[model samples]
Target: METNTQILSTEDLRSQEYFLNMGPQHPATHGVLRLLLTMDGEIVKNIEPDLGYIHRGIEKMVEYDTYRQIIHVTDRLDYLSSHMNNEAVALAIEKALEVEVSDRIKVIRTMMDELTRIASHLLWWGVMGMDIGALTTFMYAFRDREMINEIMEKTTGARLTMSYNIPGGVMFDLHPDFVKDVKAFIPHMRKVLPEYDRLLTGNIIFQRRMKGVGYLSAEDAISHGASGPVARGSGVRCDIRKKAPYSAYDRVEFDEIIETGGDNLARYQVRMREMYESLNILEQLVDNIPEGPYQMPMRTLIKLPKGEFYQRVETARGEFGVFIVSDGKKNPYRVKFRSPGFSNLNALIQAGRGVKLADLVAIMSTFDFVIPDIDR
Candidate 1:
């Protein structure tokens, strides 16, 4: 008696490529973002970010709103970077109108900008750890972040979307305790940041998950227009604050954190180090805040000349730019926003290729995306 048997070919044993949808409503995404991932078994072959779930048509709305009104809408784009978003629009409007804000206003804006950076980074740090299976980090991060939120509420009357930065200057003067609160927070944060290093950064498990994963080269970073920690992690000097000084950034001394590793770990290190740099910027400004009016005198209706204007600022994510086309009207004839999240998300298509599905979560966390910013 003989048995009939057949051996499988190499191609027959191999797996076929398939598609997976990560989210428009997944926890790791951090917002309403859908990632259409092409998968070859457990490895990601390509990633297409499906946006617009949270798009509010902010740019189109701004065209109908006054320059002052435009400031408020920008806050909704990158709510974590709301202050910086407001500043971008305000700076563009001021540039179009040829208004120079006072030195005091400049200093206050810079200090607040740094505080916002710290707060945003804190949130990202905690969330990133949580994304990779460390829940304790979320609690610790929010603990420090609350202090900054309280400070924002006291001064700007809002925590998430302050809309504090107006066209001419900030909407109001700093709270009487602003400097004292910031001064106290700096020391507290400096002490606690190291704890974060011990808790997550040095974890052997985390290191294994991050190191050498999702490599994005410096040249690719530039070609993809990646900025903030995403670019800096790859050793690209794309910090708008350093390259083109705006507000009181020129008055401060702080190093732009750069890591040449071009991996997920490098991005993580860049942000972690950036928190220290933001603290340095705050220490220099908090005590030395000048004595002057918080806001410049401006016409009730701000009308830009019949021309175009653009301003870019370094936000928590990266370059946040506002461009306006005016037909000599109180409202802009056309409006556009250059948001960092959109560019950074696009770069993932390259960095994420050939990475594991699990590693995709780690790589995306490093991006620190705000979905509305991408969709808008």
Candidate 2:
């Protein structure tokens, strides 16, 4: 629903173009994103993101560390859903080694990954709402997020950056209470997510602010390699978890939530739908926790073969792929992190072409980026 503002003035600064930078620090721009806005007065002409504020030398850091020790650093890459980072790296290594991950480990990994997805979406819902002037939804969103984080900590010993998943298997064995607690969380999240409809989706103010704002066409989103919510927002059913199933995704049943409009409101709707999808996946996986060994014991001098291996997992943000080129050594010869935010950020430059300055922030939050994901 593009706003049908009547053509009042034909030449109010449409005759002249001016340039303005939106931020590396604007809260609404999300994280450390500086937008170089070329504008004809309030209407935007172009946007270029000046990224790399949060670079931490993560790719270089992995070269020196043992394969066993590298999962900790993966957590730092996407701090929002660190477990997925840990699992992505671990899966790549496991694939390279051709090691058999146990059924128990596989199910647990799938369960945790879905949980991380929910938690990430929950946080995104809050901050995105706040970015557009809805504060109460943030609190409501975090309330469930806190429960998920606490469940994570109970199993992995740390809430946020839990380096729980590892190469051969998990760093720690599953907690004895993991089953009951996760099952409890499933119903709780089920009860709470519907409240989102009342709090944000159904609100008149939010619908007006978002509805048709920052629309991305399906072809444009695909051309840019946008994944997760960004891709799904455009009705692109491209969840890597389903496309290339790794880590037990093949064993679970879930749909990639998608919408056609690709607007700010559509993105909000997609994530809102995703919280339920994740809960659906959780309920399916939680009941069938397999009983088997968690991890196989790796030799002290574990070495990757002299070939390149790629593993792409669907993280909360998007497709997180780790391309590891191992030269038959303890260290990878080259490492590539296909960070989702970086690919999704390309959408900002593409879609910002003819939007208004005030609408820029609304558009940016739809991508749900963290700067380090781009910089790393």
Count the clashes in each prediction. Answer: 0, 1
Ten contiguous residues minimizing lDDT sum, candidate 1? 1-10
lDDT of every predicted structure (CA atoms): 0.91, 0.84
* Candidate 1 per-residue lDDT over residues 27-100, each given as its tens digit: 89988999999998899998988888998998888888887888888889999989999888888888888899
Cα lDDT tens digits for candidate 2, 83-185:
8888988999988888998898998888888888889989988988888888997999899899888888888899898999878888778788888888888
Clashing pairs in 1: none
User: Residue 133 error for model 1, in Å?
Assistant: 0.3
lDDT of 2: 0.84
- Number of the top TM-score candidate: 1
